[model samples]
Target: MKRISLFLLLSLLLGATVLYSQNPETNLRVVSVSPNAASLGTFGMIPTSNYVGQASLSIPVYEIDLDGKKFPITLSYHTDGTRVAQEATWVGLGWTLQAGGCVISVFGSNAKIYSANYYDIKGRVVKTVRSNLLGGYDITSTTYTF
Candidate 1:
């Protein structure tokens, strides 16, 4: 009976590893913002001019030490440069990356799937993010150099 129980636990553990995504720290990378958002990231700037700056890349969730213990922090996943990343502090979890007018919600302990309209410089919806899956992990973040 002991052996059977141990085997079951090990199998469950392995299954979880196979299903979970990679660690966020290992995968985060910074990239350029969408061309339109690039122009808009800066507040009070010339509205009709091209803009550029370094933004923190958003990545998926993995175990990270925010306050000593391992916790999964889902961030605003983005490949382009991050013009803004407002940290949305969870009441009992980790900080959420809340930039780019994109958002995730925690309602009565349940997380809401994020949804919003995204546009390119040409004002077209180039990307769409809406999921029945309540939790989507963060992305790998990195910076680019000229």
Candidate 2:
């Protein structure tokens, strides 16, 4: 009985490991990187002199593959050229925000807040609050990043 239980446990663990490894969505990869590309603004907000700077090459474009969907993300850099924020359009009108290496917020076409993340002082995500169609909220402890 002990041998049988151990064998079943090991088999289940191995199968779970195989399934996790084969999931493509867990592997977020950058398809391409275009340096010095045009700015797409910050989190669907219009580009201003304070955000995008004066030059056109202030933002860099990164095409990423997320769950078989391709999204072109524009990265905004600070004055020192360090990456500060990232923005990407969702579907056709919605937009997503990635700050501090984590997706912090998402907004819909009508400027509705779909999801927002709370982060710790170390810039790590603590939880995500998502709005559902039922007019309620779903809070989760999962974090997604590029």
Each model's lDDT comes to 0.38, 0.37
The lowest-lDDT stretch of 10 consecutive residues in candidate 1 is: 102-111
The TM-score measured for candidate 2 stands at: 0.18
- Please, what are the lDDT tens digits per residue for candidate 1 over residues 1-146? 99999999999998996574553332223344443333223322222222444333445555567678665554532323333553323421222343324222212222222343333333344334543133233222122211
Q: How many backbone clashes does candidate 1 have?
A: 21
The lDDT, on a scale of 0 to 1, for candidate 2 is 0.37
Q: How high is each candidate's TM-score?
A: 0.17, 0.18
Against the true structure, candidate 1 has what lDDT?
Answer: 0.38
Please give the RMSD of candidate 1 to the true structure. Answer: 23.2
Error of 2 at 35 (Å): 24
